[model samples]
Target chain A: MENVIKIRGLTKNYGKNRGVIDVNLDVAKGDVFGFLGPNGAGKSTTIRSMLGFLRFDEGSISILGMDSVRDHEKILRDVGYMPSEAWFYDTMRVSEVIKYAADVRGLDCAQEAAKLCERLKVDTHKKIKELSLGNRKKVSIVCAMQHRPKLFIFDEPTSGLDPLMQRNFFNLIDEYVRDGATCVLSTHVLSEVNRYCRHAAIMRDGRLMMLEDTNIDEDAFLKYYMDEEEM
Target chain B: MRAVFVREIRLNMKQLIIWSLTVGILGLVCILMYDSMQGDMKSMADMFSQMGAFSDAFGMSTLSIATVEGFFATEVGTVHGLGGAMFAAILAIGIISKEEDGHTGEFLLSLPISRRRVVAAKGGCVLVCLAAFSCVCALFYALGFVMLGEDIPFSKLAVFMAMQLLMNIEISAICFFISGVSPKINIGAGLGVALICYVYDLVGRVVPDMKDYLFMGPYSYANASEIFSGADIAVAGVAVGLVITVVAYVSTFVCFDRRDLAS
Candidate 1:
């Protein structure tokens, strides 16, 4: 399968500190790529650079074979991104934010938005500030998934979601992949890696620890990592 | 850019509404206070002293509040100047900084827009908001005259409001510039801008000899109080204010585009 996202020697530096250093990875089309890392492991940094939010001192990023920065606008048209932090105008109700997002993308995803909101049990009429953490996550998910972008990027997508909603999210991704969309999920949730991802890249301290298919269960992988640390 | 602009507008409207209401209430209270003072006050000198104590920041030299021109200075300068400056500072502080503060920039940046476009669009929204507020204030001022049973010339009102409009853009630009440069601080940019303006006002008041060099002071407006008399407009000051706005806005964009966002 062709890669949805391709990176070669991607390096980003914030002054003397390392943001991401010599990182390389590829997420295949129609594949659920779980990009796992510890806190401050450069997963978000790498993802942001791929999305062109941060400038990299060295390397190349190709989104479906188009240069990430050069074709950023065109790529964004069909790329659904959910940032780790959920932000919306507090005065705006959930529906209004969704409408605003949809309007920006020129997508008539209202019915889809309604379905997602209902599925996640998010109150569409309530202010974003008034919503609970899980509900706010639902808001982000609904907006991200509603547009049906071909390439999906979710940064800590399940951070505020309850277990039930998280399961719903997995099912939603399954359906999306079945329809031939690509997804790159940046998260440390091990279960999510086992449950949804066909490909996984583990990162630690601004570098890739491993890139492997999930041939073994998550417990075995955890044991191996722990055993390696002890050694 | 338009898509981003539209969203910026949606966000700015809520802010504009809040600022408009607060500023409007303050103006109304001042008008009410002015109405109540007629019976108790002995002379315009007493009134100017009282008002000076209340709003020394707005006046260059105390004037008789009883006279319409002095009333305009007190009402427009001190009342609107301080309030308007504060209003502008707060508005500018958020325009460039709020998205990053709320972590919304991460989400928005991931979209197809460039950093430059984001900066320009966001800055443009601030200008739109300021313009909208100016229109509302002008409307209320006209309403104030009607309530007082005064028949002021529309042309004079236009000239006065025009100078205010120019001054406001300058204030907003400086505050917004502060926003882009200092994101970790909450409304620190606005407070800083207000302080700088207040200092300029002080220097203008304390040193009349240096008035040639310190045109930035709101006191400059005071020195040219006759400009609003429907006689002659000070086109030069307005031109200087425009230049400051442009430079401040451009600096803000440069700072925003180069900074690391995910951090």
Candidate 2:
């Protein structure tokens, strides 16, 4: 398998407080890679650094064979991102936001977005501020997924989604990985990992505790977490 | 960057419209009032003396208001002072912080552009809107001259415009820097700050002692009736503008790079 992301000795600080500390990881192409962590476990910090939204004091990050900082914009074009909290302009309708997103990525997602929204049970015509949290999540998901990107980086993407929708999302993600797309998903939903991810990394308190390749049910995964945290 | 610039301009339509209409109508009304009061003063000093107490309160006697040039002085210092300050502050604060406040900044960062490019594109949008808005005010100025027949010097009109542009650009640059650092809701507070400075400008013009302190106001350069009296470009004004724009751009770049993506 080809390497899609390679990080070495990455460290980041926020005004003397630690953000990410000497982190290193790799995800192969065609991966459904789960980044497992509770809140404030450096999941977001590591992701931001990967996107070139944060500065690191020491390390090298390469994505798709390009230097992360030097080729940030070009690399971003090849990836789709679903932020932990996707926000919208209050004045813009769901359709407008999705359309603008597609345009920004140099794609025309209008027709695709309409179909996607319908599948996700989202209304495209309403203002963003009027939508429920779950609907807004669907909007962000549709926008992020419409580009058919080489890599999909998501941070807690399933938070506002209902259980059924999450299961549907897992099916869609499985299809992408089967088709050779790469994924880096961070979420507290261990079941999502059990459903789709081939590999996973567990992080805690700004440290990577382990990276695992396992087949386990949610019941077993929690038991595993308990044993590992005790270590 | 170009696409970003285009998008910013498209979204800025309502702001441009409101500022243009609001400033244009007020300018026309002022011109009509100027027509009614034209040559009513016996002398330049007499004009100063008649409003001596009121002028003393606001600082209007540094140069003469009796001549057409003096009329330009009054217009640039007063109209542009109040209106331009609010316009610059409101637009600048809205451009950057509005995205963050609404949680759109994170989504915007996901696009294929550097944060520097994003800031630059929005800054360019500011200049573009400023240019178009200036032209609208100029059109109203021409109409004012054509309809009112006040015989204000054509040269003085250009000087009035140049001075207004300088003030607007300077204040807008300051507001942009603040937008990068402050929370989105703080924009209204920034506009309030601009208004307070407007009062300072009104004071600086009538009081020469206040001239030294006029640096406190964004439009204080309009107080240059002493130097701009003969159409001097005021290199000091240019230098000040360069300083403000440069500092704002640098601070904005640094802030955007380090701040967490809110959306």
Candidate 3:
């Protein structure tokens, strides 16, 4: 399998505190890679560094065979990102916000975005401030997926979503991946990772604890968290 | 860049309107009151002259209260000089910090555009809005002169307004640099810059030894009284202000590109 994302010795430090340290990761082309971690395990920090949203103190990240920092515009052009928290301009209607995102991506995405909104049961006419948390997440999903990017990077993409919507979201990801796209989903839910992702990487204390296939022994995977609790 | 610019302009339009109305309506009111105070110019001037520190702080020392231009230089100047700088500070500081404050940095910074482009687009929006606010003030000044039948020179007023706008840009750039590097410190940066400018202006006028440091404050660069008195533009002040504006913006762009954005 060809690697779509290659991160080596990626280190980010916040003053005396550690953000992510000596982290190395890779996601193969057309592979659904799962990044699993508990709260404060540096999952979001690592994901953000990959997108060039935050600069790292050491090491490198290449997305689609291009340096993420040097070629950020090029990489992001074909990448979809859904942050852990969904936020938008409060005064903007959902439709306007989607349109704005579409414009930024240089896409004629109205038709696609509208279709996503319809499928996700999102209200496009309401001001963003009026949307519920779930609705906001749905809006973010539409923004991220409207262009049908070649790679999807989702940080806790289903946190505020209902179970049904979560299933629907996974189905959407499945549809895209079947068309040769790749996905990296970060979540703490091991079952979700097992059910949807082919490979999983677990992180703890700003470090990678494990990287293996999801078909591994269930007891061994449970022991990793069990060991974490003991520590 | 175009998308960011358009979004910024749309988001800040309400604030622009509010600030412009505050200054514009206040200018009109002050001009209307000038007529009532015309007959008591001697008494008013004497009263202002007696309050040494107060008169100097408000630029009422050399300006007579009877003349429309003099009254504007002293009264409207204090308001716009301080108020305009404050508005600009809030605008620039909020440009970057608002993303973090609203927890939208992840969404915004993740866009395909570079951080440098983000600064350019957002900063351009702020500059435009500030310019528009200054234009509104100038419009009100022209309206006041017409309504009061005052024969103020348009050329001098234009020079003063230009100076005022430059001062605002300088102040905003300073705050932008602060917020760009460390968005969490936005409140401190905004208030700190404002307080420093106010103190420098006060000290320059009240203390004999601190007069040399007059350029430290934007107040001096935008001195409406001197401009109204037909004094030639202060090339030194303009040069210094422009330099500061340029340096601050360059720093903001570079820092934002390298800085770690908060999640």
* Candidate with the greatest DockQ versus the true structure: 3
* DockQ of each candidate, alpha-carbon based: 0.51, 0.57, 0.82
Candidate RMSDs in order: 3.7, 3.5, 1.9
The candidate, 1 or 3, that scores higher on DockQ is: 3
The order by descending TM-score is: 3, 2, 1
How do these models rank on lDDT, best leading? 3, 2, 1
Count the clashes in each prediction: 0, 4, 0
Candidate 1: list runs displaced more than 4 Å.
A217-220, A223-230, B1-15, B21-66, B218-224, B229-232
The C-alpha stretches of model 3 lying farther than 4 A from their native spots are A209-211, A216-219, A227-231, B46-57
Compute the TM-score of each model's chain A versus the native chain A and list the values: 0.92, 0.91, 0.94
Give the per-residue lDDT digits (tens) of candidate 1, residues A1-231: 798888999988878777788998878899998888667778888888887778788999999778987888788878888887777777779998888788777678999998888888888989888987778788888888898889889988998887898889888888988998999998877778877888888777688756656555766556534534574
lDDT string for model 1 (B1-263, tens) is 78788877886787788877667666655554555665554475464456542334334235455554556556555566666677778877877667777767766676667778877887788778878887787677667666766676477667666666667778888887887876553576576676677677666555656556556554354332354434345556666777888898888889887776744
Task: Give Cα distance to truth, residue B242, candidate 1, Å.
Answer: 1.2
- Best-matching candidate per TM-score: 3
What C-alpha lDDT values do all the predictions have? 0.74, 0.75, 0.85
Put down candidate 3 lDDT per residue, A61-161, tens digits, no spaces: 99999998889999998899998889988999999989988898778998888788888999889999998888999999998999989999998889889
State chain A's TM-score for model 2. Answer: 0.91
TM-score of 2: 0.87
